[model samples]
Target: MVWTEILVPVLGGDNDAALLAIAKALAEPFNAAINVVYASPSPISLFSWAGEGGYGPTDVAVAAMQESADRGQARCRDLLASLDYPKTKFEAVTADDWIGLRTVSRLADVVIWERSVSRGHGFLANAFQQILLDERRPAIIADKPTKADGTIAIAWDGGREASRALRRAVPLLRGATKVVILSVPHAMAHPCDGSRAVDYLADQGIKADAVVLHTQGDAGQAILGGVRDLGADILVAGAFGHPRLQRFIFGGTTQLLLDSGSPAALFLSH
Candidate 1:
């Protein structure tokens, strides 16, 4: 479970620097290849033409779209050139090119996605969600650079998703100066205690301390506070641990974490 290939999706925005900085920090230790991708939307859909007037010409619309995509690609290349990370590889592809993007994601050990990308509902958002949901890969949601050797916190709940996350985070945890398992006892009934998670990490030769949190609000808030208090650079947790229906309407812990502006980077697996 070592990370060898890291994927970072870019949109040619000013935030690309922040995203790449996070990727570089994660890649440096492992000597991993950073795949910097510029993902653009496909040509304008047929139904999305002039609303009040008749539909516009298809060729013109597609040409305009391609021109915009070209500009985005240029921006990504320029940024990569400026930073000059030795192990970075750059590519530009359309978000609708599912087969192509999925193939690239398949080989990636972990994807580094920007916080804004997760919040978006556009084409890039669809691509980001597919990489996690359809591909079933691990990801690091970051808004800024994360410390490569800082304390890492695992949000443990004794669920299948949490177990998967813990297992996937082993390689990264091995490098952390400190590891902590944060559990919310009052949030939900756990199948097993946080000690089980700590023991599992111990088996992997990674010593971790477990702390039970008694919270009055949501589990997500408690976990965030715990990470902040511990000064952890990264939070390892399962994405969408609750049922889809429940999270979709009322928003679950995963949603809350994703929407948060916390500085702590999230290492999530679904």
Candidate 2:
């Protein structure tokens, strides 16, 4: 269950060093190859141009976007080379957003994304949204550089998505200095036994602690608070158990954590 290929999107041309630092740390454990990709713009659809008079203005716009992306692509390659991950090989490529990033992710073991403060946060941008929804690959948001010896946390719900996320995170779990299982007990019916999670970790020869907390407010907030309390640097969870629309229309736990972006980093699987 070790990752072998990691895809990193270097779109905005900011925070290259930080993103590469995290990628290098993770790749060191498994000798994973890093692919730094700069996504070129997707052409407007036929229907889109029809509504906006014609392709007269559209072609000009597309050309401008391509030019900007080309500059960013050069920055990405230069940045990656400077980092010098002596352990593994890395490649930098330019491609259209739909076919390039998405296709690379489909074959990658995990896709790495970093949000730079200089760049405005575009949570639901088309390229990001498509990457998140691409069921073939899991994505990791490296909000902060991982510690030299980091602690890992897993948010558990006894559901299939949670289980999937946990399994996908085996590589991280094996290397973490400490592991914590964070759970927020339901105010309604029976809650999962937190000890079972601890026991499961024991089976893998990994020691862990379980922290169960009663809700202080929303269940999501409570769970996040628990993660902070434990000082876990890396958190793993399943992304959006509910449909994208359902979670967006009515707030859900996953959405809450995503929107706030606290606790530094998360390894999420859909």
Candidate 3:
């Protein structure tokens, strides 16, 4: 699929505008149907608030939560409707008192989420992290509104996740005439082996050049420098692996790419 459906969360945060901009940009390429998801927090009962008697009664709290959810849904609808696209292309959905991550994963093709500190640190990060960690869908975490123009940098690690990301990014890659496949050296690394990734791209009719970067300092800084040198418009990379046991292990390269604030449309897949 070419990602004809896009999911944008309306969390009533400062980054709502950035999410909307991402939605707009995606719609241009995919003619995407936009889904505005609002995850209403579960209401806490008075019985649970034993220490704070000032906490409202159960019924009052329930009512307040419902009202807040209703307002959020309305606001999302209004914001999406105000866009340049047709209103029929956008829909508002509410997932109150439910598992937000599961709901988003089931319905969205590509999720556009925000990494905001002001949002208080619960569902926003958790939901996005879950989408990245569990779901097969590609996700774009908008730290700010991104302009999809620069050279597209593909972080190839020769893993399943990286392969999935490369497959999912075909549409974007096809449009980009200039693409670079980056591989970082490891203990098991070989020089000519990296050229196979370039060959794979050539088979798909995408003429890409592979450059092996030595694992010296920060992988993120090296990628940013490479992108700047190439004047890249976007960065294509796999989401990589997550923490499993107590060893703090991960597919390191993807984590480094995510932390890098290069102006690019991060195409991440698990």
Runs of candidate 1 exceeding 4 Å displacement: 44-54
lDDT tens digits, residues 159-209, model 3? 677677888777667666678887766623433335777887788887787
List residue ranges in candidate 2 displaced over 4 A: 42-65, 87-97, 116-124, 187-190
- The pairs that clash in candidate 2 are none
Give the distance in Å from residue 226's predicted Cα in candidate 1 to where it truly belongs: 1.0
User: Which scores greater on lDDT, model 1 or model 2?
Assistant: 1
**Model 3 stretches astray by more than 4 angstroms:** 44-56, 87-101, 117-122, 144-149, 187-193, 246-251
lDDT of each model, Cα atoms only?
A: 0.84, 0.70, 0.65
Per-residue lDDT of model 1, residues 1-270, tens digit only: 578889988888778888888888899889888999887777764335565588765787789878877887898888888776788898877665566677778888899987776776645677777788789789899878888789999999998899999999998999999999999988868444599999899999999999888878888999999999999999999988767788788888888888888889999999
Root-mean-square deviation of every model: 2.2, 3.4, 3.7
Clashes of 3: 6
Q: Single out the weakest 10-residue window by summed lDDT for candidate 1.
A: 43-52
Q: Sort the candidates on TM-score, descending order.
A: 1, 2, 3
